[model samples]
Target: MSEFDKKDVPEERIGLIDLMRTIKVVPLVTLHSPEEAVPLARALASGGVPIAEVTFRSAAALDGMRAIHDQVPEVTLVAGTVHTVDQARQAVEAGCKGVVSPAFSDAVVDWCMGSRIPVLPGTATPSDIEKAYDLGLRFTKFFPAEAYGGVKTLKALSGPFAEMSFLPTGGVGFGNAREYIDLPNVFAVGGSFPVPSKAQRQGDWKAVADACAQARQLVQG
Candidate 1:
């Protein structure tokens, strides 16, 4: 069980909270061209999921974020896989309102918190959650959630760190997303499901949109 906080206080910033609550399904998108970013974001938004985590796994991350920010303004874009302060700075300048990482990094978390970007710092253990809570962050991402025990772990964690809200990513997909979404402590769950690799590689924007629509319906229902 993770020993962190007692409860979460909802944030006023929609983009920030979307990183937690509404974006229960996040598209971990990595496009080859920045041009693909806007269209993809538009598709997701039109399908009812108005957000995405544009990861730094690809060279086009910043450019994609810029394009999405400019052309698909309704999509709440977040910069992900931030490993350094400079990257975080660049992401914020590119119009990302939030940041996420695959693992916990105090420096990265501090940088985002210091800046205007609200952060969903990853926390997979009790200690990680403690550090995040100490930094005044109530929301966090539980990377490799399934491998680390998933719902059972979260339920156990709630007994101690009930205040901390989570957005469990890694291994999250259509089959089990609702199990996480229904949890009071889980504000959201993120995965590559919204834009499956095969679909994106095939340039199936419609499939992406349809997937997002189905995901939205599942979470809502």
Candidate 2:
């Protein structure tokens, strides 16, 4: 049973989940310069994967998000590694369609729920999953997936969390991405694998695009 009396889960969030399921892969992007935003987003789109999870690990996250929002409107943007309500608010203002936290922060979750913003709180254990479930959240992120048993853990979770879906991130890469995506409980896989670090740092947009295309094929193939 849910702990909350009324789950104010927004209707639009369902559409977002459906979109993610179709995409099958989400690029976990961290920007060092806002200038890289437009080109990187365009590369992802050109490669047939038009979604990016711009993490707030860098100082330039907000500016980069704003640039992508304004210049590459076709790409779906979600804020990642968010730690505070302030960051979440800024992310939405910068044009992120949703908020993704690395851990389940009650304040952040409550705020996003009240504001009608879609939030995917990270979960690593049954307790964490229960917290999200009690709040009426059906979708959550399984972080550090490789470190936490990878496909095995997801399989174990499926029995107890039959109605829940997951976005498995952390340590997910091209080699085992399809394995994760094949799980019935997984909606999509998230990682920095699609945007290779060397390619991104060297401003090799074509390499980045090629990496994305390969990743897309790996899952959809």
Query: Quick one: best TM-score, which candidate?
Result: 2
Best by lDDT: 2
TM-score of each: 0.91, 0.96
lDDT of 1 by residue, 1-221 (tens): 23323234324334467444655677778877877888888888887888888999999999999999988898888888888888888998998888888888888877776664677878899998988878777788998899999998999888889778888988888999999888988987888888878778777888889999998888776
The models' CA-based lDDT, in order, is 0.81, 0.92
Candidate 1's C-alpha runs over 4 A off are: 1-15, 18-20
Q: What tens-digit string does per-residue lDDT give for candidate 2 at 44-160?
A: 999989999999999999999999999999999999999999999999999999999999999999999899888999999999999999889999999879988999999999999
Model 2 segments beyond 4 Å from truth? 1-9
Error of model 2, residue 213, in angstroms:
0.7
lDDT of 1: 0.81
